[model samples]
Target: MKAVCTVLIACVTMFLVPTAVAQDARRITPEQIDRLVKPYLDAKRINAISIGVIDGDVSLTHHLGTLSRDIPNPPTDQTIYEIGSISKVFTSLLLASEIEAGNLKLTSTVGELLPDVSKANPALNSVQLVQLATHTSGLPRMPANLDLSNVTDPYATYSRESLHTYLSSIDPAAKPGEKSEYSNLAVGLLGDVLAMRSGDDYDVLIRRVIAEPLGMTDTGAMLDPSCLSDSQKSRLAPPHDANLDANYNWHFASLAGAGSVFSTTSDMLRFAAASLDPPDNDLGKAMRLSQQKHAAPIGSGVAMGLGWHFARDKQTLWHNGQTGGYHTMLMVNPKLNAAVVVLCNTAMGDVDALAGQFIQTIAGMNVEPKSFDEALTVPAETVARLAGQYEIAPGAVLTVRADQSQLFAQLTGQPEVQIFAISETKWKYRVVEATIEFELPDSGPASSLTLFQSGMKVPGKRK
Candidate 1:
């Protein structure tokens, strides 16, 4: 039910490599996702998840649950939800579109696209456009100078000049396409350069090139959805977090291309339709090119095209997104002209696993409905005993709290999150892919606790 959670990594929402098992799946309906997702909505774990399924010539959509816990109204196809990094797919398509129009090429270096930045930072000169698209660019996940104080609205203050300053400050990370890293900054810079070259706003470019031609009027670069027309603002579903707390809607100042598209399932299904069978237009040609594998990204076993991640089966191209408040997943199979997209208004641990399970069920595979949370029942006394504060580092404490029915953990300077019990002393986080194990002694409160995440273990002593 939950996978890993990342900060500012709405994988291009959490762009971990997709491991969805591909099989001879039978025809799946839009209702399949609906049935599978009711529990989360019923429990108020998620506000709503708008779903769209495309199987061959048939396509359908469903908006499950209500718009929010307080709002009893269900979301409509026109309900706006942030697609997160799925905007990267559209950004890559912009690159493809530019290439198709003879305005750019994969081999075009960053230096060529933005000579001023490249001149200041020669290392960036060798970074080819394709590397940026495939995330082979040597850029770190984000700029080192990024203001951490505003994690929820990270890109709000990042400007073109900010990117320029960072580019000038650093040396090249590697030969273009020499490394495998999932970088929001790399793709953000790519969009900046593309916009600089085209002399248009990133949003305007996407609307001109992708949305207008495809008739996806409901989709566009994410802005303050509330600032738009009154009608659209009302249509925008409010965002929530895993705690069901009110969450912020992310805005982009310079990284809209990285993760800044507000769209609906119906519009996304249209995008999927185009991906399954590209039209004869120039944009269509670019779409065709984007779906092909262009690089073997370095860090993981994931294969990548322009902005798409190739699943292990190498047949399904998919991407998932998680911002502070919203989570999104998009899967497309061009060969079968089939696809499924799930977009939610609240943050969950892993919408990818949820969607992946739905994919398995559609294969006519028997996958019993199971909860992706702490399932082992522990006595209330054990739960109460575990509640305490542990010191991980100077000024960094892990606080564990428990109500009679549920357990929660909060790190220093971070929001409190619910933790589910998997064993007598082990608990896992549903927000991100991490876990904590209590270092219990023979008796008394647990001696210590260890945080496990991303292959690292940090020990925390009783504070």
Candidate 2:
């Protein structure tokens, strides 16, 4: 109901208090952060957020607001928020570790691990594992064979049979090395290949190699109720749209390299710190290489490293995540030995601006992020008329509700939050880190709405 899009403030505004033991601690002051973020959070109508920062060996955790808009659960360092595609970084590390150990090869073909894959499409057998992991393997966001009947759980319905059928008919839209396109299917398949090559399940491989060694007990693909301590499990807040009933779930598939892992701020801090400072393990150098720039001239002004994404001109290596009702951003700057983790419980609230603002403050750079009101605009009449629910498709419906003179969008099986009007016809929602815009195609569709995200847009007929 409130401003759903929050802006980022400067560091001095975030930390107003002269930090204690300022001479020793190189951390940003809490007062300065509060001065900067609190008002922004209020203005954006964010329900709950857990932020973590790492500088050298010292890490700072900050929690503000409640976990749920309805229940108001307080967030803490241990709060487990689904770090969306950030899971790819972990999966990438796993692949890198295996490659470093000679258990797997980046150039290995998927057919080597899954024999049936070659039988489906001989051409696909030549696609190297690295290309799949880097999303340059020419796979689409998802398999064309998938049926969207299970909208509530997209991946849960994609079984092995469906994957095989899709691969058997694989016809790449482009040459493998021609361009860089983000493919959830490609990376997801990479995870499965790594697991098969190592003769270990995704869950087991991660724990045996990465999680257990780093003391990241709370992070994993699936949480066992019997294994997790009450306190540890309690740290998980109810994510956006209590209707979803649980944190986002990733169905096991060959495409595991894309996104599947779940973790908390505390666990991520440990992971980020290890990434910045390689421990006495084979993965240390491998991860460093993974975070380095490996591809270029791609979308996001950067290219894929081993499994990580690197900025074009900066030492900042980062990845963002979006699942059903969760959005996450994790970044680390090798030059600064500084890492940041931004986790949110709500799906539709914009936190990217907050992340940028926080980074500027921590880096002592001055920048002003646009606020929600300034970030969005729409005609008063259209804003008023578009305040009701509309069916985007036959079985898929989205509700656009007006709250506090602001517009919010709610898709079935998702969390509800105010939407930011980025333009006259475009609305951006954070739940899936995507944008939806309406358009009237002059030649064909007189009245149609289009959804856009990550440079890809699809038209949806208004129902």
Candidate 3:
């Protein structure tokens, strides 16, 4: 079975590297970076990792690990990785650009842009463009009608017709603009509407609206091999699952706006620089507008601004994304005039925490890493008793299983990882700073499991 671990364990342990010499925060040496990253790579057994940082006048990019275990080629700054939901930021940029040009407005309804959609469901008339961008349109996280035959590439078969059908039949759990929820469907719809207004497909719209303006030549929804030099193509990092097995790249016919862009660390750094200090161009103006606070999707601490999420305390604007085989993070602190981009080819590494630590380090802040205790002895029978599937959400499930003396967990569409027992009923994931506690009723088998992570308690009932 594939070992899935948390991003925290992989990212924090690296920052906790002990050093006798006091290192200069302003000028971090490449050797220091390698020392911090190499151990995490070794522990997780990850393939390739590329990190880029922009701190004031100091800009640095480093590539570590091999492209794949089979091929010992090291990745470079030009290595392309699928930057899933980070595409939302680009789609919102398009919205801002159109709004600036008087072509569209945030108040513009989905029905207004796509007349055929209104004909099918008049309810769509109430769903505004801003709602889609902010994830306040009351849309579900995904279409319930999605085909699960190919779990690895879930969105490959989802077409324009499928989106319309799902939208027409959806009974939103909350009213439009009533609550803040993350929705890939909502943002995908926003991209489609923007494309319709621009008289271009999602890919072309992004190139013209955001990529071309910023000179991010290599960043786009559909990257053509003919357009790239042989050297650049050779640097492209192949996607890998949690098990370190080769995974196929994702394709989206209609939902391409949500998470279909392939880009390099260099291109992303350019994009980050533009976001930090927007130029006088139209795209720059739109980029600034996209960063303005719109709504507090999850009630005021970290608010949503177009596609970006604001960390008020950190004075940072950032977004993270994950594809089937890759995990990525891009963060910028305009206050400090610094930004960090972390890209990993393997799905298992914790690029999120890695980027956070890099940003914090650039800001000259002290970071304290979390430590884990040794697992307590638990009998094989006790672990087996807790092994079962638990329903976390309507369609999301977490499956727990025992492999001889060890226990593991597998989330829907995620890889399985060995979980260490903290007690008979409580366990911890070594990769992340999270805990799972199994509830046993006065009688038979385990009834439920509660997952504690990121200040949320998610309870899943055994099926």
Candidate 4:
């Protein structure tokens, strides 16, 4: 009934990138940008797009389409959006600030800050602050005890006690600093520990130190109706799905560090400005430190720097975030002193590619990032043969079905999405880079399938 980001994959900061190389510096006209972006909106692939670009002394803002299918007004700087994993960048900035204050060290262990958690699970004591900031702490993407009862607003009722309980329940999947795994739990924990030590809640700490000083007033952990003025409340860009259908916004309770931010394009541009040019202040130094390469390569052609994700061979940095109903991307080319911020009211994976193009174009790099949308048409009979329910985990099922000539896939607690058969058994999603490959038994229904997403191979067996 709803086109959601899927229960298990919601709020995961994943990107499908097409590489960019610097050949020459070129600038496209505003008309060109409209031509590049309006097609997606016109095709109904998304509801709205808000992009901000800053280069040296030049700045521009572009808005396309309505805020939602029912809302005919275009978005403005006042329009607020949930920034998803981009929130991690702010959390990590606070981490760097703490280090600058001589309050915490990169080598500081979880046992030192979160003693109670480590006391409960001794193995976690060795996880260092660097590992947490760099996604090398070996923590899972999410807490296993996370409540999904309200999939739309999944994190609303998650208590701090729940987070502690989950932390104390299991040993890390890998040794601290041994491997890199994008963990919402680890970063969220880092924020919590920093807050505990700083004598401020995460939201208040960020506002008082980070956002307030930089004049980014419209940003914080979450948007509470009671805290906003009438004009501000009316400016909210209500969340929506890929179909331009209404969708519920995410709510973060205990793990707000993971992705609870609600900010506007202008506000994000303000943050990006600070990132491009660090001031002679603690927060600025923290920003500069957070942008340096502090760890090995992460994701595709990127490395982790505190919370920021940077290119391996270029002076470029970026991070993308997605929740159930929104997708956002922020990119900065410090060497070129240029940055771009992309905010969307719809939940789809295309924002990464769009943002990449914007920065590459502005930086004068050849601006085409290869997309993973190359799809193939398969026989209707093959689609029908693969139609069945596959159990992805203990209780999670992935249901595949064939309607007419189209094939669709639906996770147990998520909405059904159309899939394109690239081959007899392999299918890909247009809105996301995920794929599914079914194994036929040669006689009847498919026996199993493998899901390929963000470099993780998840298998499912017929139920």
| TM-scores for every predicted model | 0.83, 0.77, 0.85, 0.86
**What ranking of all candidate models by TM-score puts the best one first?**
4, 3, 1, 2
Instruction: State the RMSD for candidate 2.
Output: 7.2
Q: Rate the local accuracy (lDDT) of all candidates.
A: 0.75, 0.62, 0.73, 0.75
lDDT of candidate 3 over 1-463, digit per residue (tens): 0111122211211122221223355454466567667655765546898989987788899989888878898788888887777888888888999888888888999888767767778888888898898878888666677664565666667788888887776778878888776677788778876776677888788877778877887777842344345665676688886557887666666777778777899899999999999999788778888888887735422567888877645357777776767778788767677788888887653556667777766766665442335567788777788899999878779899987668988766454667778888998864344679999766578999998765667899999
Give the clashing residue pairs of candidate 3, or none. 6-431, 7-350
Deviation of model 3 at 269, angstroms: 0.7
**For every model in order, what is the number of clashing pairs?**
13, 25, 2, 2
lDDT for position 352 in model 4: 68
Q: Where does candidate 2 have its weakest 10-residue lDDT segment?
A: 3-12
- Would you list the rank order by lDDT, best first? 4, 1, 3, 2
lDDT of 2 by residue, 1-463 (tens): 1111111100001111112223244456566566656764666456677788886566788888777656666688777765656767777787778778887787887777767778767777777777776767777556766654454445655666777778888888766656565666777777766676678867677777788888997877642233345775677666553223344433444444455566888898888888888787686867865776656645442467866665533566767665555656777776666778887766543565566566656666554544544455565656665555556645446667665547776654333545577776677654444677766343332255665644455455556
Residue pairs with colliding backbones in model 4 are 25-364, 26-364
Clashes of 4: 2
lDDT for predicted candidate 4 compared with the true structure: 0.75
lDDT by residue (tens digit), candidate 1, 386-461: 8899998665688999887578887654446778788979987766657889987667788889987645577999
| Model 1 backbone overlap count | 13
lDDT of 1 at 110: 84
